[model samples]
Target chain A: MTGLLVGLGRASLSVFERLGRGHLFLLRILLGLAALVRRPRLLVVQVWSVGVQSLLIIVVAGTFVGMVLALQGYNTLITFGAEQSLGVVVAKSLLRELGPVIAALLFAGRAGSALTAEIGFMKATEQLSAMEMMAVDPVRRIVVPRFVAGIISMPLLAAIFTAVGVLGGHFCGVGLLGVDEGAFWSQMQAKVTLLDDVVNGVMIKSLAFGFVVSWIAVFEGYDAVPTSEGVSAATTRTVVHSSLAILALDFILTGLMFN
Target chain B: MKDPRLMEISVGAFVAIGLAALLLLALKVANLAQFSPPPGYEVKAYFDNIGGLQVRSPVKMGGVLVGRITNIGFDSKRFQAVVTLRISQIYNSIPADTAANIYTAGLLGEQYVGLEAGGDDTSLVAGDEITITQSAVVLEKIIQEFLYSKTTKSASPGS
Candidate 1:
């Protein structure tokens, strides 16, 4: 009994310690933002690596998801004689929930894992230490730009995801399914609101998810044990932890905003 | 080193497309234009029971949207519901004796106020009261009335 209690205590203590360290690391990166502003080119380069590279996957996934939503929604709505409302169902779901959440998940897997591996490899090669030896703040020179880039890329990607998804739904709903084209767009416009559903649901949710995912990726990379195996482990952890954070944060955010 | 110009151009393009997507989401998918309240006049109507009628419900004249319900209040003295509608400026010629009736859009759908115009030369202006207003039809009340009428008919036949 004593051994079990000791083990549990140690586990909880480590978790809290990691949480505290993560917050501090995030604060340091945020403080480093001022220095990053002086060299906007650094930000542009990171955005290219993170945002532009991830575009193809976001669009592909968005189209498939939107098409699937329309297909499934049509089947259900038809039973109740509401197939005409397919646009409402599809647009609302994509905008309010699936768009931000799925985009964040994909971002974690794509750009997030890349961030961890790149940073982790730098630590493994003593590149970070060498920067410190050269009188450079590694956090400002390295982590801040990527972190800010992640933050900027997420909302844009999510917005693109939602737009592509809406078109995909339209193709499936109006084109393939033969629902009236006019009704499809009109019902969607009448039902979904700008501030409540679009801004609050999609944009704000993506922004929050962006902050969480980027913070996790950078922190995990910075905290990784400096070895080849350690870099791999950190990369895996970045994807897993970031995915879990996106889902859990989505739930909390939905409760706060929608309620 | 890779071409910096190419990298910057790609990033700029990415940002541009993303902003365009957001703009499309706002204007095309969601109701952005409807957020701005149009130039309109307000009119009040009293009903016995509002039912599921809510503020922002469309007030239609002959199935055409002319205004929207702005506020729903309870009149303590008359024990009635007071619904205020903001009619657009273009629809300023609505007859003074227009009767407002609550109607459901579709089966198990949202309810709105439907106005039937009367043959009056004078038109309703801001703050004018619409006295001829019908309350929303509650499903349970309708079912109960139907059942009561059936029982009464059966009893009369027996007598």
Candidate 2:
């Protein structure tokens, strides 16, 4: 009984310690952001790296998901003699579930991992230490801009994904399958509510996911030991941890927003 | 020759694309675009049972949609669902005795208010009440009734 209680206490203590660390980390990143106001180039470069570079990948993946949904949804809906509602099927699935989750997964793999690797590599090369030696805080100079860029990029990536996906669905459902174009668009407009699906479900969900993925990424890179293997491990851990955090947060946010 | 100004263009383009995507989603998927009905008039309908009826249900005339249900409410005193319809000015010929019925859009999909034209020469106008309205047929209730009737018929056919 005493052992179980001790184990429980240790778990709670570790969780509390992690919470405290994350809070302090966020505070420092905010300070770093404040320091970057004079030098806007740093922020712009990070946005270019984090956001602009990821566009093609997001678009291609979104299109594939949309086309696949049309093919699959058509088959199932036809079984129920509801092929007309293919628009609803594709639109609801993308906005409510796939858009945020898949976008975040891709973001984690692409930009999030890249961030971890970049930061970790700097730590491994003693560049961060050198900056410290020069009386320049590495966190303020390096971490904050990347964090902000990730936050900004996520919702944009998700929006582009959803838009391209819709077009893909339109191509497959209307052009290929010969479903009425009017029905495809009109039914979607009639049924899908703006505030419920887009604002709360897709946009809000993706933003939260963005914060989690980037937070995990930047933290992993920052905390890594100064070694080549440690840097590589940090990159790997960034991908794995960010992916998991995104999915878990997706579930929680979906429940809160939809229900 | 990678100009630093190249980034400015890309960033601007990115913001433009983001806003455009948002506009498209809002217009197409979320149905926020004002497909503005060219001026309209309000009409009310009362139903004994609304079933799954909701606001924004399309008001169809002669199998063609002419307006939308703008509001839905429960009238406790009347013990009925009060539905407010907004009919397009383009479809102003609806008679005074026209009947409104709640219908599923695609057999089993979303519900809408479908209006059936009546024989009265007098046309309906703003703030008019559609006295003749039929509520939606609940499928489960219909199935249950069918099953119950079958059991009873098999048990007591001679009567």
Q: Which prediction has the highest lDDT against the true structure?
A: 1
Instruction: Give candidate 2's TM-score.
Output: 0.91
Give the range where candidate 2 chain B is weakest over 10 consecutive residues by summed lDDT.
Answer: B30-39
Candidate 2: pairs in clash? none
lDDT of 2 by residue, B1-159 (tens): 167789867876886897788788888788786545558999999998888877777788877878888889989999998999999998888899998988886677788888888999999999999999898989998999999999999989766
Candidate 2 chain A weakest lDDT stretch, 10 residues: A14-23
lDDT for B8 in candidate 2 is: 68
Candidate 1, B1-159: lDDT as tens digits:
299999888999999999999999999998688867799999999999988998788999999999999999999999999999999999999999999999998996789999999989999999999989999999999999999999999999789
RMSD over all Cα atoms, model 2? 2.9
Clashes of 1: 0
What would the per-residue lDDT of candidate 2 be over residues A1-259, giving only the tens digit for each residue?
9999999999999879866887789888876788888878888888888888988899999999999999899988888987888998899999999988999999999999999999998998989999999999999888988898898888988988998998999899898987788888888888788889889877898889888888888988887767889988889989998888888888888788878
Candidate 1, what DockQ? 0.90
lDDT of 2 at B10: 89
Q: Which residue pairs come into collision in candidate 1?
A: none
